[model samples]
Target: MAVPRRVVIVGAGLAGASAAGALRERGFDGEILLFGRERHRPYELPALSKEILLGNADEPAWVHDENAYADRDIRLHSATAVERVSLAGHSVLDSEGEEHRYDRLLLATGSHPRALRVPGSDLRGLHLLRTLDDSLALRTALRQAERVVVVGAGWIGCEVAAAARSHGAATTVVDPLPLPLRGSLGDEMGEVFRAVHAEQGVDWRLATAVAGFTGEDQLTGVVLTDGTEIPADMAVVGVGAAPRLGLAEQAGLILTNEVPGGGVAVDSTLRTSDPDVFAAGDIAAPDHPVHGRIRVEHWANAKDQGAHVAGNLLDAGQPYRAEPYFFTDQYELGMEYRGLADPRHDELVVRGDLGAREFIAFWLREGRVQAAMNVNWWDDGDALQALVDRHAEVDARQLRSGDLASLVP
Candidate 1:
């Protein structure tokens, strides 16, 4: 057995960090170099929009401390961004024209904020919350502003709107869609979130589109297509993120498309089209045995995929399959979900109380569990997931009976 000399991982986010740690844990003693574009170390990303936005988190604790990385023998390269990967030569070029060779390379470049094309988007007060710097800028704006307008009623949009409201900012969310989160949770449960935010004092503008900006220098307000003007001290865009795949493409790596949310396609083992290079985190789009090929941007997915990549790197024979999972916190509500629940599902069964602000909605297709949402009642998350995983034809009556133990076969 030939021992590999070096392992290079790009993007020191959750995926890269986990891969490094898992490599050492799995007994890979060769040179392990972790490259991160950001000066800060890899840390958890979920808190940026929720706790960190509310001014309750210390940004320094985002990643593992230097001492911890030292103990793990994980060579940390901070403030260095990989410009390109030379797959044939097995080396990656940094921004400063430096090169680092690797026996195997992992591209975890992740995703970038998707900026809107509407005019006034370049204003100083217009911000997007994806990185620590973005979070800092948005938090400063949230504290200084009395009125805030959030465009795009998606996860980040809703979570930031809730955070702004918590900071005493008069917040209004504008979405062209009929309701928030209709793309993922469907209209049946979107109503529950609408009422939740409404009760928390967030003004909602459904089916409304932004025409342009109002201020000359900074963003003071937004002009809607309906000719309604709403005051805003700052505008935070949370539409979504675009995968950073420029490096992969430049390396002549075969790209995979046709996945939901636009991500690079990889195999079940998390290996990209180039077998020598693997991808994880928000960028790697793997074919789900059940849900087909999908690109997922979730904390749980990163961790699972990272471990899977490590196993495959050690021995190519190992099989890697990831079950996607993610959670969100908004206005005293904790919502968690697992698996792929398509947006086009025709039947949705609601278990528990939607009015009481606590319930689980199961998305089914052909009597199979496609996806599910659990709000404030995570105790039954496993049961619901089981029912979905097994493709069990759950009796609506038995599901709402408050007893899930019987449903688990």
Candidate 2:
């Protein structure tokens, strides 16, 4: 494949910034044009939930300074959204009725928060966290909120609940699952975090769904599906997010990942049905040789794929070879997870004391290490990742008692 003279990218987040950096570092010298819906520069999305919500907005979240993009001759068009991708002429139409031509196209549109659809959901005090503005607004609301009813105990919901509790607000987390993070950590391990939150005065309402909100123009309280009502001044919906693939869908690109808000299907090299069009970040469902077609919403995976896709654009010989990695932070516990293992199917094994909040867990299937997680571990993530990649048979007795570092080989 020859070098493209003009490359158009459809996202202005970390993934887009990282790709533009990679292209310049590799000495591509091409016209890299980036478009984003937000007016702000590319910043970290993970920080919006934690640091920004806690009023610690001083944290550096920008991927790079303006000088970095300017020095590389990259053109960034903020607050301009791409409406559709046309393959016939290799151009994209923007929201302002402008068309931009490109020799190569990349979609890093990322995702958006999934809104709750129930009676009274249109009321005020209902919030969804996705962008910086959403975080800022929610933070201001939490400062004055007396009681917060957090819907869905996923990562965002759990973290936001912790922040509200820190502000002396009575926090009630509602979820239909038996435990929080059950989809990722299974029942037993998920109980660990649940216990911590409970100890911190979080009212856990498991196996329950919200019937609706009760109020005229503002949320006065939340009514549960079982006819139980929880008083609240505000509610945060963190059920999950869906990929922003409207442009791809309109362009008739192949769609996969059956779940709502899934991703665009692509080959291992990140090429879509149209060879000139590619995808990266949360919007890409690249076919992994080991895990098949899966869309991972982890920050690390998106950043890595962004850089790798740039190389594929220059030379289409190499496939995306990195595995999935993710992390979560709540209260005193910090977790780093590696590999792709279904929590329901994998046999769970623990290595340290849950009481001390310091330990590592392994997800083994047929005696082969499929995935591993470290709680409160800062420097041991790479080792756990190695243990997962080795795919070696495990000795249960050794895994439970021996040092986790020894399992890497």
Candidate 3:
């Protein structure tokens, strides 16, 4: 394939920004146009839930300084939404009605928070954390809130609850799962998070569904499915997120449905059905060699996949095989998880003390490690990743008490 003279990227999030940088780094002297719906330059999303919500930082953690793009000759259009895409003509129409053509197109459109569509969902004082503005608004409300109810016990929900509790509000987390992070960590590991939050004074309403919100204008209370009403002045809904697939759908690209999370389907090269177009970040559901067709929404996936696709855009022909990785910080506990594993079916093994909340937890199927997480046990990330990459059988006893380095071979 001949090298493209121009590249257009939609979504100015981490993925798009990373791809732009990688292209320049790889000595691609082509015109790069990056469009972002948000007004701010590209920034990381992880800190919004932790540092920003906790009132530790006000500004976003920018991926690059304001002049970085101009310095690299990358044209960035902020607060400009791409309304439509013409695959046949190889052009995109922005919200401003300006049509721009491209030799190659990338859709890193990312995802948006799934709205809570129950009764009273439109009430005031109810919020969703996604953008920098959302985090700032939620933080402001948290400071004034006396009672806070967070719906969903996932990463965002848990982080928001911790932030609210830290601000001296009465915080409660509601979820249908039996425990926090049960879907990701399984019951055995989920129990550890339950203890961590319990110690931080976070109330759990597990195994229950949200019936709806009960309030006149401002959120006054959260009504559960069991007919219990938890009084609250503010509520945050963090059920999950869905990919921004409108452009992909409009362009008639293939998309996956409910198999490995659901998003625009891409092959091993991160190339969409249309060879001239590619997808990355939260929207790209790559047919991974090891994990099958999975869509990872974590920070690591966005950062790595963006660069990976840049290489493929230059005809690298290399398959994306990076292990899925993510981290979380709630209250005083911090954890990093590497690889993917189904907690329900995989056998879990621990290398440190669970009571102390400082250990490495490994999820193994048969005798090979599928995933590994370190809770407050730092400095072993590479070793843990090696264990997962090796995919070799190991003694359970050795995994629990043996040296991590010796087990890889």
Candidate 4:
């Protein structure tokens, strides 16, 4: 089954598109069928929140041209919904109720924005940024949305806040955490990001909870848990995403209870409970040899996992071994983080000035560097990533010194 002659992939996000492209590059001449719910072909999602939202780019960065797919003999079904997949029957049923048999399958079905459950969430100006359409609509609304109230201060919220400010919107980002990015970068590094927002004039309502929305047909303002009302004409919720795993679960694939999406359990090579059925991207809590069982929700992980699955499906030998990597860009700040990043750390050692906006922070546990991140720095991301890879043993002094170079193994 190394060259499974017929292959079917569901969910046409970055992962699905990358898999299809990688299969061709891997020299697989098998007949491929790809399905996407969106009308447009697979595109780069990072642009949706970054370039497109800032009006720097008009169209999404498509993963492949229609002509290119046709050139590779890949039958890509855009705007076609795959209603259900049957592992027992070895077939997938489309919305039209047509069945397609496949020797192998991949569920690249990514996550969706966790919708806000407040009363006025149904209002016209309330939004969530997840897809291309969502970003486009939000960008259009930002043009006229003064006094914008952002409900979450995560990556999406921060980016949208930055974009709204660039368009002269009075932006305010709220989050329950004391520091904006505390959930990912730890408190010390999170304060750096929080200060950046404050420096840019973004009103920070940190450690505050949203009581509810206070408008009927259209969003007018946000009500805080303590009865303080923030006047607003629009709001964006970036509370993070929950994976979409209903299809895989319905197909009897085993799932991890602790993961956000009721994550589908996959082995090192990305094969799910059923060997013929595989999972990737946001929904997969893949068991990596180095990191153990973990789920990474980022563009790079999606792309890498997609490519990894294709190679594993062909040779069945290579393990999904690439270290988890992710990046974020907020206003003038840009960063790349690598290795295992657990938010529940007791301490992090910083090597540079936060006010100056150039730094490298390391999370260490018992003298072992668990993870590292670089912000607004040049050409040092790869070297920092190497330190995490080797679990380089270094004390807090070296990490906190201009001797940042010595920390690299």
TM-score of each: 0.95, 0.97, 0.98, 0.96
- What does the lDDT come to for candidate 4? 0.85
> Per-residue lDDT of 181-247 in model 2, one digit per residue for the tens?
9998898888999998998999999999999999889899999999999989999999999898888
On TM-score, the stronger of 1 and 2 is 2
Candidate 1 lDDT at 27 equals: 88
**RMSD, every candidate, angstroms:** 1.8, 1.4, 1.0, 1.6
Please list the residue runs of candidate 4 whose C-alpha ends up more than 4 Å from where it truly belongs after superposition: 402-408
| CA lDDT of every candidate | 0.83, 0.87, 0.92, 0.85
lDDT per residue for candidate 3 within 1-409, as digits (tens), equals 8999999999999999999999999999999999999989999999899999999999877888889999999999999999999999999999999999999999999999988889999999989989999999999999999999999999999899889998999999999999999999988888888888888888999999899998899889999999999999999999999889999999999998855457998999999999999999999988899888889999989999998889888889889999899999988899999989998888888998888889998888888889999999987887898988776588889989888888887
Which residue runs does candidate 1 get wrong by more than 4 Å? Answer: 1-3, 60-63
Error (Å) of candidate 2 at residue 289 is 1.9
Q: What is the per-residue lDDT of model 4 for residues 1-409, given as tens digits with 9 covering 90 to 100?
A: 5569888999899899899999999999988999989888898788877899999998888888868888998888989888888998999998777899988999998999987787777887889998899989999999988889998988888898889888889999888888888878777778888888888989999898787887778888998877789989899988989998889878989999766557889988999998898888999898888888889899889999998899877766577887878888889999888877675853588788777889877888778888888888766766687788887888888778645556677
Number of colliding residue pairs in model 2 = 0
Q: Kindly report which residue stretches of model 2 are placed more than 4 angstroms away from their true locations once superposed.
A: 58-60, 258-260
Residue pairs with colliding backbones in model 4 are none
Q: Per-residue lDDT for 58-148 in model 1, tens only? A: 5734545668789988898889999989988989998888999988889998889888887887787888887888788888889999999
Q: How accurate locally is residue 151 in candidate 1, as Cα lDDT from 0 to 100? A: 90
1 versus 4: better lDDT goes to: 4
lDDT of 2 at 363: 89
Q: In candidate 4, how many Å is residue 351 off?
A: 1.5
